[model samples]
Every structure is written in structure tokens, then in C-alpha cells.
Target: MYLIAIAWMYVVVMMTIAEAASPGGTLLGAFFTLVLYGLLPLSILLYILGTPARKRRIKARQAQEAPAEGHPPSGTSSGVAPDARSQPPAAAQTDSVSPVREES
Candidate 1:
């Protein structure tokens, strides 16, 4: 994420440099044009810093995946695996039925 931000900043800086190279209102015009183009890195900067959804998802994902109380996840185990039948099914339940069910 930091790398993305850094790259975004780099693009923004390059844009500012390009704008500086241009003369008169042309530079400013080009600046606005750059903004008009979605490729402008400023949006990415704002999104990385400003968007609540991105922030919340990042926080939630980090929390959900973090190592808990000094116990790491058991990914390297060589022991016998547990029986699958003992565990409950992990399928999603759907409440919405087919349109035909409405008639019934």
C-alpha cells in the first residue's frame, strides 16, 4: 500500500513537473486536463487517505488475519487432519426463492 502511495506521489510529482515545463496558462490548462484524466494520481492519493470504505476494510482485514496472543496460524502442521464429517457444513443460506415460489 505504501508502495502504491509512493508511486502515486511520484506520478503526481511528474505531473507537476510537466505542468511547470509548460508556459503561460498552458501549464495550468494542462494541469486541469491532467485532473480530467482519471490517470491522475491525486485521486489515488485521496482514495488511499480519504475513503472510509478502504480504511474500514483494511482495518477489518488486518484484525481478522492477525496472529492472536502469540499463537501463529497452524499452516505447517504434519499431523493427521481432523475428520471432515464431524464439522458443520459451511455453506451460505439463501432466503430468496425462485419467482415461481411467489405463485405457490
Candidate 2:
């Protein structure tokens, strides 16, 4: 993906140079060609194409920072530690705000 972007930028740079060297082409035209034809579209394309990679990087970093199974991070859990508890909480002792209904 990056290789493609680099190749494209190289092409655009050459095109910009050709534009600047042309008899009728102005420096302003070259600058506009570089920016409008090269930088803008390439930036948007790379960002869109790199979405999955960015997401993967984020997930990988989070996974590395995440605590191991059965071991919660410090100061994040409320009350007693999950491993320290010997029994489950009562069914009625839920934190749900919605009322339960019985089936007919």
C-alpha cells in the first residue's frame, strides 16, 4: 500500500517538474498540480486504505496494555476483587434498572 503511494507521489513530482519546466506553465500551476493532483487525493486515499491497519494497530496496543485473564488492572474494579470472591452475587442483587417481567 505504502509502495503504491510512494510510486504515485514520485509520478506526481515528475509531473509537477514537467509542468514547471513547460514554456507556458507557471510555478503557480506546478504548485497547484502538486497539491491538487498529488497531495490531496493521495492523503485521502492513504487514509481510507489504511483504516484497517490503523484499527489493527490500536487493537494490538490495547491488547498489549490489557491485563491477563482473571487479573484485573489496579484501581479499576469496584469493591472486592473478582478472584477473591468465593460465591456469586444473589440474583436479586443486580444493578439493572429495568424491571423484570414473567412470561404468560
Candidate 3:
């Protein structure tokens, strides 16, 4: 699916070239609009196909692959409690951060 989108980028570029080289200027204008309209959606689709989505996809896939409760295939974070375990999630702790203590 992702490969299809990636290839579509090249296809769009080639289409642009073809549209430019086309004999009928009206055909070129119509194809140019098509390529313009497709560019944003294609870039977004490609990005989703690429790295950011890949991580979540792999994690979700692994979790689905294993059929056990409380076993989420050991993500970047540990399965244990922050206090019990060595490292804690960033959002979990608040002591290190200070209050604003604003004045009028």
C-alpha cells in the first residue's frame, strides 16, 4: 500500500512532465490541475506510509500477534510501575516541575 503511494509520487512527477510536453495545451492544464490536487493527499499518504506510522503499526501488530493479557510486547517504556521500575514516564512525575506563582 505504502509502496503504491511512493510510486505514485514518481507517477505524479512523470505526469507533470508529460503534461508539459503534451500537444494539446488544454490537456496539459487539466493534467496540471490533477497533479496539483493530488500532491497534498499523496504527500500525506506517503508520510503515513513512512516512519511515524510504521512504529505504531509494528507495536500494534506485535500486541495483536501475542495473545496474552498484560503482555504488550515490551514497548519503549517498561511494563512495571514508574516508582517500582528505574525510569518513569515523563507525564507521571510533577515534583521536578515548579509552579508559576503568578502575581497581579
Candidate 4:
């Protein structure tokens, strides 16, 4: 892919040089030709084509940086105390007073 891009850029550079050297061609036109024809499209194409590689690199890096599966991350717990493991959840209280409604 890079080889193709390089070849394409070479062709565009030659075209730019020809445009610049032509009797009626302005240097500004040649510059625009190089940038518009060569740089912008090539950059966009490379970025689009390289997406899968970028994703793979990111995934590999994440896998490498991840902790082992056997151990949990630090600063986090299972939320249950060791001694409370045998206890059942407490029932809700039923002693609260009920709301009084107007006689209307």
C-alpha cells in the first residue's frame, strides 16, 4: 500500500514539475496541483486503508496492558465482608407509621 502511495506521489510530483515548467503554468498552480492531487487524497486514502491495522495495534496493546484473569484489579472489592458471608439479608422494617389521609 505504501509502495503504491509512494509511486502515486512520485507521479504527482512529476506532474507538478511539468505544470510548473510549462510556458503558461504558474508556480501557484503547480503547488496547488501537488497538494490537492497528491497530499490530501493520499493522506485520506492511507488513513482509511490503515484502519484495520490501527485497530489491531490498539487491541494488542490493550491485551498486553491488561491484568491477569486470575486476579482482580486493585482498590476494588466484592462488597461483602468475610464475616457477613454467612448472614442472610436483613428484612425490611414494618413498624413505620402509615400516612393519614384527609376525610374528604
List the global CA lDDT of all models: 0.58, 0.82, 0.68, 0.81
Structure candidate 2, residue pairs in collision: none
Structural similarity to truth (TM-score) of each candidate? 0.30, 0.64, 0.35, 0.65
Model 4: weakest 10-residue lDDT segment is 73-82
Summed backbone clashes in each candidate are 0, 0, 0, 0
Give the higher-lDDT candidate: 3 or 4: 4
Q: Which runs in model 2 stand beyond 4 Å of their true positions? A: 68-104
lDDT (C-alpha) at residue 61 in model 4: 71
Ranking by TM-score: 4, 2, 3, 1
Tens digit of per-residue lDDT, candidate 3, span 1-91: 8678768777776677677667864665757655675677887767776877789899788788765555544644455455546567776
Clashing pairs in 4: none
Candidate 4 residue 92 C-alpha distance from true site, Å: 22
lDDT of 1 by residue, 18-67 (tens): 77676653676656755754255566666767678778899777667755
Candidate 2 achieves a global lDDT of 0.82
Locate the minimum summed-lDDT window of 10 residues in model 1.
73-82
**Against the correct fold, how does model 2 do in TM-score?**
0.64
